[model samples]
Target chain A: MTIDKKLNGTSLVIALEGRLDTMTSPQLEEELKTSLEGITDLTFDFEKLEYISSAGLRVLLYAQKVMNKQGSMKVIHASEPVLDVFDVTGFVDILTIE
Target chain B: MMTLTVKAHISNLSMVQDALGEWLDSIGCPMKTSLQLQMAVEELFVNVASYAYGEEEGDLTLSYEYEEELSLVRITFRDQGMPFNPAECLEQEEESTRLHVEDRGVGGLGILMVYKTADQVHYSYRDGWNILILEKKL
Candidate 1:
């Protein structure tokens, strides 16, 4: 998966492309670990993302937790399949989606 | 029925997905169903790779059969690793899903998803092989 980070002041928008599964979630996890130090707002742009498994959801949950204390995080432009995963996992209630 | 055997390693996830995706596409499986199947397969495969062998390398065999008449697909994962039944963890995971995000733990979510999305999930230990079968109606 390709993770593109755009930092405008304190807001960080990370766009993802391709599958986010067990093999790829760690990459995003590591990226967030290093990039989320001072960010006040975070956005996950899933416009180009193709798929997401539980591993991806885990990372999202982790990010949400981190941002909960620091700022706010939301997911935007998620595809139907990706949305379905969030819905099935009940993450729709926990994470902000747009 | 088609089968593909590969090492139970995290790096082989794409290889497994590609082969299965190609077969699903050739069979005209709907995009939504294909994605769900792929997710379930990843969850199960990763489970085996992470926990089944316990630091030892092993092989995971993925066998799938499509029933054109009923529009059903049955996929099986067989591994010669430790005996673990994914289905047994469903109850606990289900409870965790209902908890608040702060209280929820990350473990077992994958297996919980496989159980929720797949039409049927069956597990068996036969002749020292851990066999898991997932059936989905396309």
Candidate 2:
């Protein structure tokens, strides 16, 4: 999946427009690494995202951990399949979604 | 009607992944399936890269067999690392009762994704090695 970043004050909005899985998780990680310092709020947009693998969840967890220290993270527009992934992993409770 | 195989050191992940991605493209896998495969490939291979060698370099072999008529691609990740199958981990409670974020971790999400994403995942620890096979139906 392609990850694009936008910084709005304390919140960091990462819009993912592809698939998140094993191999690509590192790419997302790299993207976050360059941008994650001192950020309080995080937003993830799964608008064009099609799928997420366990590897992807691991990456999300890392991001959540980072945000937890400073702020909160929100995930928006999770598709049914992707939502199923969150449900299976039980990450729904940890994240904010609408 | 095609077969591709490559065995490389764990550090060359991108080169190998790009090759596999190219092969998948040639096989005409749908975009969504392609992304899932890519994620699986990265996760499985990275696990081997980090945990398998441990201050030593080990070999990783990847093979793709295409069944054009069936629209299926079977990717096998073979490694000489410690025998570990992320799929065998127990499922966490649907409602977890933990107070700390530390409880959140070392959880079974990675392996769960493997089982959830792949159509079939076969794991066998034989011949002194670990073999994880991932299948995606296009």
Candidate 3:
């Protein structure tokens, strides 16, 4: 997956393209780890993201936890399959989706 | 029925998905069903690769069959790594989903999803091989 970042001051928006599975999630996790410092607003754009596995969800959860303490995080343009996963795993209640 | 065997490594996930996706497509499986099956396969395959052999190298064989009459697909994973039964993880599936974010652990959610999404899942260890079978109705 390709992660495109748009940082405007403290707000950061990440747009993802392609599948986010076991092999790819670590890339996103590492990106978030380095990019989240001092950022108060984080948004994920999933319009181009095709697939997400549990590994992907774990990364989202980690980001959410960090944002919960520092600021806020939300997901946008999530596909139906991704939404279904969130609903089934109960992440729908934890993460803000738009 | 078709079978493919590859090294149990994280990098091989895409290869597995591509091969299986092709098969599913050739069989005229619905897009949603194909996606779910692929997700389940990734979870099981990653579980085996991450924990099954620890630092040692191993291989996994994936076999799949499509029952045209019933519109069902069955996928199986066989490995010689340590014995682990994914089917039994269903017991913790519900509790894991209900836990709050602060209290929620990340490890077991993958297996929980496999159980929840797959129509049927079975596990067995025999002849020094761990066998996991997942069935989904298309």
Give the true-contact fraction for every prediction, in order. 0.70, 0.32, 0.73
* Ranking of all predicted structures according to lDDT, beginning with the best and ending with the worst: 1, 3, 2
Least accurate 10 contiguous residues by lDDT in model 2 chain B: B90-99
lDDT of 3 by residue, B47-73 (tens): 998999999999999999999899989
lDDT string for model 1 (B11-120, tens) is 99899999999999999999999999999999999899899999999999999899999999999999999999986788888788788989877676888889889999
For model 3, how does the per-residue alpha-carbon lDDT over A28-82 read when each residue is reduced to its tens digit?
Answer: 9999999999999999999998888999999998999999999999999999988
TM-score of every model versus the real structure: 0.96, 0.72, 0.95
lDDT of candidate 1 over A13-97, digit per residue (tens): 9999999988899999999999999999999999999999999998999999999999999999999999988887889899999
Provide DockQ values for all models, in the order shown.
0.76, 0.36, 0.76
DockQ of 3: 0.76
In angstroms, give how far residue B103 of model 2 lies from its true place: 2.2
TM accuracy, model 3 = 0.95
TM-score of chain B of 2: 0.79
Best by lDDT: 1
Tens-place lDDT digits, model 2, residues B1-138: 333444444557667667877888887777667766776676677677767767776677787888777777888877787888675463452323132454676444555556667899998888977877787789
Cα miss at A53, model 2 (Å)?
A: 5.5
**Candidate 1, residue B37: how far the Cα is off, in Å:** 0.5
